[model samples]
Structures are given as C-alpha cells and as structure tokens.
Target: MAKTQYYTATSIDGYIADANNSLDWLFEVDEGTANPFGEFFAGVGAFAMGATTYEWVLENDNLLEEPQNWHDMYGEVPCWVFTHRDLPPVPDANVFMISGDVRRVHEAMLVAAQGKNVWLAGGGDLVAQFAQQGLLDEIILGIAPAVLGEGTPLLRHKLHVDELILTGVREVGQFAYLTYAVGDVARMGRHLAAETATLLPVNF
Candidate 1:
C-alpha cells in the first residue's frame, strides 16, 4: 500500500516559495543536520510536482547544462511533472511532463513506486488537487523561521479539523518539522466531534 504524501518546506507564514516564486529566503535558514528528509526520501519511489516547481529546480540546478546533477538528487526515481505544455527533458533524468486527471496519474505513480511511498512534491495547488481526490494521505512540513507576505501557498484546499491528525513534531534548529496524517474530510467532522479535538494549525 503506497501512501501519497506531500513533503515540503515552508515559511512560518505558510508560503512554500517567495513572491518571485523563488526559494532564496528558504536557503538563508539552516534546517539543522538532523533532518527527516533523507529518511522520508528513502521510501519515495516516485515523485510528482507542478510545472512551476519542476521548472524552478531545472533552472536552479542547471539540469540541462549539467545533466548528471539531476541524478545526484533524485537518482533513477521516476518524476512526473504535471504540466500542459511541452518541456525539455534533462539528459538521463527520469522525468515526464503530463496533464490530465490526477487520479489516473496517481495510479501510475503508485505502480511506478512499486511498494514504496508516492511523494507529492508541490506548488500547492497540485497537491490540493490530490487531496480533494482523496489521493493524498500525509503531509510533512519543515517550517522555517521566515515569512513571505505573499507567495506560493502551502496548500489550497479547505481541510477542516478532522481532516488531519498530528502524528509527529520535531524541532530542528530554527526549523520546526511537523507531520500530519490526512483523513477523509467527509468523515472527519464526525470523527473530530467524537474525539472533541480542535483542528491542527494551518501555519504550514
């Protein structure tokens, strides 16, 4: 059973990227040596991201000029870029440009992931689309000690109290790592009413 998880780093104000859609601010913060990214990435057989995120990585890393660099980050792990336009592929990187029903892509991602987990690399809206389809299972965020008044949002869906369960939290230097298990929103209200719990903070 491969679970679909949205793993991302965000500003304290819930922005994944700055107004320019750049991560320069995020680079300023030190997330500490002991981070959970490595452990989580080890189980991700496949990842999917929106065009903006994919393009940003491709440009920032110079994947086209230094093609091999792409492998160093993601190896042979398959990557799906949800886009409507054609995009150039980086030499040997296992990347694909696709657009259509997210459910269909999710099924493909699961198959490609084998028994491993499916990672939802983000641009916010794309991940929300998955959440709405009930294809998203978990959310992991590393909250940096910074804020971008307006930028790329962390998530675009209206998930209420019962929609998430706080599974874990870790304070790593200036960053706060949080993990939440996503539940069925339709049945979430009922569950929360029974438990008498408040909704988790949507800071990031």
Candidate 2:
C-alpha cells in the first residue's frame, strides 16, 4: 500500500525552520553517507508543498538561474504547490499550482503516484491540515542536534501515544531519526471516546 509520508528535518526543540524560515541549522549538520534521501525519493511518485516551501526552493536553490537543479532534484515527478496567490512555475519542471481542499488534491496525487508513496514536503501548517483530516500515514523526522529557541513548529496539532506508534529509531551522525506510524483517526477517536466515558467528573 502506498503511504502518505511527511519526511522532514527538525531542530532538537521541534522546529523545522528558524525564525527567519531558514534551514541553515539543518544544512549545517552532516546527513551521513547513507542514501536515505535518494532511496526515499525513489519511493516518492508525487509530492506537495505550500507556497512558502515552494518559494524557498525557488530562491534558495536559485532554480531560475539554474533550472537544471530542479530537474536534478525531482526529475519528471509531478509537484503540486498549494497556494492562493500566483507563483511562477519552473520551466520544464512538472509542477501544478492549486488551492482548495487538500483531500481532492490528495486523491489526484495518489493517482499520479502510480502505486508509490506520496510525500508531503511542506511547511508545518500544510502538514497539519493533512494530519488533522486523517490523511497522513507516516512521519519520518530527522531530529538535528541543535536547537532554535523558537521558529516554525514541527507539528501544530496534538498527537497522543495511542495515535502515533513509534516504529523505528536510528542515530546517524549528530541526527536522531525517528519513524512513527500514525493511527487511523476513526479508530483512535472511538478509543478516546471510550476512555473519556470511563472518567468521572468531580463537582467543584
């Protein structure tokens, strides 16, 4: 089964980017000799991201000056950018600009994925929408050794132990990689409801 995964690197304090929305801290760390990025990309048939993340790639990678970089990174894989404002598309790059419910776009993404996994490459807000709607299946977080007092959060919603099961943990260089399988929201909601029923409220 193709899973919807959120693969991202974050600070020790759970921020994916700094206050300036920069990933300088992430770039400063050693990613190791392992081809995790390549391997993961191979399994990703499609990807989606928000406007900020899309623009970051456009500026940070200088995609305009070096259009080949976009091809080198994503190749022919289709990228969906969810944004309200108009954004320029990279020449020769397979990208679609869209807005509205993520659920509809998610369905389209799955079709494009062609049995491979769908990667949610995003700013936290976008990922939050997916997870909140019970669309996200897995989370692979590469936790860096450094901390950013405050910045963009890794997750904007509450995920209890029952909702997220730890599946794997590995330490690579200075980063601690954690993999978690998100539970079915319907099942988790029912379980939580049962637990709530068992609790007695005290009259204050």
* TM-score of each candidate structure, all chains considered together: 0.89, 0.89
Off by over 4 Å in 1: 185-204
Weakest ten-residue segment in model 1 by summed lDDT: 185-194
The residue-by-residue lDDT of candidate 2 on 23-95, one tens digit each, is 8878889877776778789999999999999999999999988989999999999999999999989998999
Local error of candidate 1 at residue 173 (angstroms): 2.2
Q: Would you list the C-alpha lDDT of every candidate in the order shown?
A: 0.89, 0.90
lDDT, candidate 2, residue 138?
89
Q: What is candidate 2's TM-score against the reference?
A: 0.89
Model 1 CA lDDT for position 97: 87
TM-score of candidate 1 against the unseen true structure: 0.89
lDDT string for model 1 (4-117, tens) is 999999998999999889999988998778857878899999999999998899899999999988898899999999998888898978998899999999999899999999
